[model samples]
Target: MTSRSAPDRLLSVLAAFDHAHPALTLTDISRRAGLTLTTAHRLVGELARWGALERDASGTYHVGLRLWELAALAPRGPALRQVALPYLEDLYEATHENVQLAVRDGGEVVYTEWLSGRSSVGVHIRVGARWPLHATGVGLALLAHGDPGFQEEYCAGPLASFTPYTITEPELLRRTLAEVRRSGVAVSDRQVTPDALSVAAPVRGPDGTVTAAVSVVVPHSGARVPALTPALRLAARGISRALGWHPPTPVPAEDT
Candidate 1:
């Protein structure tokens, strides 16, 4: 096998930890990163000393708080979360459901913020979690506003299905996107999980381009799509305006 660069090797050590393996011993890191024991030890020490990784009392390493501080500086990460948090809170207060803000990263949506109410339905989502664009309301909202060429290409093939309701056919997905555009909202009906339903709306930037999406998830058994849609759209627009988006002013009819 070709030797990895120093930077690549170091990054692999950190990448060894994920949602499933949030903490690992030095030997575990070595095996997961495909490096020798000595190399893993050296890289892990360097990262721990630099505050990018933290070693617990059990000798297992996890991502450090310092990395979180750096992540906060990402424009599409914490920076956007800081702007949309208030509106998200308001939406949660109004519906007492699970409120989420997500941004599209390629063909997937990365959830940036989530607000859960006491009575909210159980949803298996956390900050930084990713889901395909065809399986969630927030994902659908972002996909509908994405570039037409990219949307067409994404709809072409290889769409993953999480549940029976997930849109796997290209033509049906195309129609769904068109409906999202016309209705100004996207509804995900048990696409991700059979018991969950979501309603989402696009959040625009200063240039009036959709840069993110916001949604509310509730139990599908007693879902109220009509009752929830208005609140979700209002919260999304509130966040978009906070991000400097101005609704296009209607042009007056020209005198004949």
Candidate 2:
């Protein structure tokens, strides 16, 4: 059997922690990282000392602040969040709905920021939650603006269904992406959940490439897509502008 390299072994240990399993014991890490108890203990000790993991009084280890400090340096994660937070806050204040900022990573959208009021409809989204590209508004906006070849490949792959309304057909998903591109806004009605709807618009970088997405999720029963589209578009434009994107003249300013 070929042995794993040192970097691979270390990363495997870190990969054991996710949104679902934030804390773990030594045995859990050993099992999940596919390492023997001795190896896991050695690596865990190194990581904890280096501040990548922290152990509590109960001997359960959680991600440490040092990792967070490093994660902040990632341009798409905390850096994007810092630039988009004001616009997200504005959208949340205006609509009093759940607002989010996300960027595409592989076939999924990774949410970077989330804000919601105490009375807003509840959703299964958090700061780092991931969702499929065809099943959420932000995901649609990002996927629609993605490279055409990659988009086609993603559309042709298996589409997971969270609700009956999710776009499962490749042709239909292609059509939806086209519409999102044409309209500069993507509306997801009961796609992620039966009772929730989201309206999203793409946020662009300095070169006008779609870099991220901003959205507001509200209850599906009285969702006002027509009313929400304008505000959502404006917020997206504001974020794009802050990111150094100069909206083109022939195209509408809101499409940036």
Candidate 3:
């Protein structure tokens, strides 16, 4: 730790906090960050002073609001959410179910926004939550639209299985991606959990690249994919439009 660069050491402290471990005591931070107690203290104090972290009355440290302020500046985070919220809200209103918007980060999809009604189906999801690219609807949508070579590489790698229905076979996953591209939507049925179904559509940026995804999660028992597809696609399309995407015009057919 002492020999590492200053930026790496500081980032290590911040990286210790995550969705699973949002609060950490000084000792916990030291051990998790692989830093000495004195080094942890000095860095924590500096971070708290800079408003990157906060120390509570009990002395536990938490990610501070300043980080959120900075995260809002990310183009794929708050900027995308700001434009997608209304459409997400509309989708939520249509089904009164769980609506989500996410962007891909390497092999995972990071949720940027989520909307759930009081009676929405329970899902293992929250804002800032992450899941592998082959497990969830938004993940599959993003993965299918990603670079072709990367998609093939990802399929060749091992896939984590959360339920019996999760696609663990690489060939099946390849076929799934082809279907997603063909249909312009992705359905993840009982993949993440035994009783949740997710239908997702891709969102495009100004360059017509797949930049993000929108999804609606509902109970698998009575999931109506046909009913949900239109609304979900509408929300995705609205967000894409707001992001300045224009569908490509078809070329004129040539005479024989």
**RMSD, candidate 3, Å:** 3.1
Whole-model lDDT for model 2 versus the true structure?
A: 0.93
Identify the superior model by TM-score, candidate 2 or candidate 3.
2
Q: For candidate 3, lDDT tens digit of each residue in 111-176?
A: 999997678678867888889989999999999999999998999979999999999999999999
Give per-residue CA lDDT, model 1, range 119-196, as digits (tens): 878997999999999999999999999999999999996899889999999999999999998888899999999999
* Candidate 2 worst ten-residue window by lDDT: 247-256
The global C-alpha lDDT for each of the candidates, from Candidate 1 onward, is 0.92, 0.93, 0.91
Determine the C-alpha RMSD for candidate 1 after optimal superposition of all C-alphas: 3.1
Q: Compute the lDDT of residue 21 as modeled in candidate 1.
A: 98
TM-scores, all candidates, are 0.95, 0.95, 0.94
Which lDDT tens digits does candidate 2 get at residues 1-256?
A: 0389999999999999998899999999999999999999999999999999999999999999999999999999999999989888889889988999999999999998899766978886888889899999999999999999999999996999999999899999999999998898999999999999999999999998999999999999998998999998999999999999997878774344
Error of 3 at 10 (Å): 1.1
The residue ranges of model 3 lying beyond 4 angstroms of the native Cα positions read 251-256
